[model samples]
Target: MDHVIKTLTPAARPPEAPGEVPAAPLRARPSRAEAEAAVRVLLGYIGDDPDREGLVDTPRRVVSAYDELFGGYHENPGEVLERTFSEIGTYDDIVLVRDIPFASHCEHHMMPFVGRAHVGYLPVERVVGLSKIARLIDIFAKRLQTQERLSSMIVTEIDTVLKPRGVAVMLEAEHTCMSMRGVQKAGSRTITTQFTGVFRDDPKEQFRFVSLVRNGIG
Candidate 1:
């Protein structure tokens, strides 16, 4: 129940907010062969024998691993929410999908932060599929991210595409950068939450959401 709650990057603008400029498409940087070459260079720089029989294929493996690690670049969050249904009859209260587990790379160190997400939205008229919420989380999680940016991006994507009456997101993650290196505080976790519309404007609604996310905890 105890965790750190601070933005990893303070000066950068939040990923949400009306009129925020869309992120420019990232240009192609290196081909797989080029990436493998770079990995080989790194192995050499680290004083490893790149051509040693045991290490010769490492560069190729690393490149293949990166393709999966950073695949969020190819995903469009809006598209995932496009499949929705409005068939819920008079069921317009909070729709929550909790304990959605995910992993993401920290943009600063390219290390991993693993966590579970709690996402909830007050429906206006339309509601997206439950699995779509999990898939939405996955799409964003596959990218290099700061937890701050990641949480905002999730809420923004749901609100923008689903036209939800409100959105609430809570993410609790353990950053490997802190646990494996840097300060090296293993087991330290980070908790972050964001809200928009009714979840932000109404305290009772916010409290209800928090309680639900924490599973009725006060």
Candidate 2:
């Protein structure tokens, strides 16, 4: 049986005020044709003919994918954590969620970095639903990112929103830019870690979190 934790409520994401910018605009302000034109120039610079039958719609397709891939840019991560619930009535031990899948484009190469994130936090007063944790990952991962910054942002956001006693985030991934081209090392993986609050102050707690994640705990 799946152990469902229904006690954890879905956190409310408050709507932006009047005249406020939406966290993410579903529609792009600029016309799609302009985006398509930009992609056409990019393909041309790469020595590809944008007008060729095989490549004719490539520009438009790229623009469409770009809209989905970078949609996080228009969204605020903080808003995902705006509402909190404290009915659990306890705050002492670490809360761990592992194998949170994510995909990102490397800022350096614009190539894909696919990986899993392991997040742990010691709640001080409140908690958020598990889905929100994944949403947090999306907010940072959907942008061009360095793994280091991504890990740091996860911890920072959790710290800010939950006011946790401590937070820890670890990401391990293989970058397509590294594995598939240039100085290719096909199986190479990068791991990044960030810790704050109690996790930083207590080495034992930090080690426990790391060990558990490495051992494949959920």
Best by lDDT: 1
How does model 1 fare in lDDT? 0.84
Q: In candidate 1, which residue ranges exceed 4 Å CA deviation?
A: 1-27, 216-218
Residue 106 error, candidate 2, Å: 0.9
TM-score, prediction 2: 0.83
Residues 79-149, candidate 1: write the lDDT tens digits.
66776787899999999899999999999989999999999999988888899899878878887899998
Candidate 2 residues 100-192, lDDT tens each?
Answer: 999999999899999999999988767788788999799789888899978877887788768888999999999999999998898889999
Q: Which candidate has the highest TM-score of all?
A: 1
Provide backbone clash counts, one per model: 0, 0
The CA-based lDDT of model 2 is what? 0.80
Q: Which pairs of residues clash in candidate 2, taking residues 3 or more apart in a chain or in different chains?
A: none
Candidate 2: misplaced stretches above 4 Å?
A: 1-31, 216-218
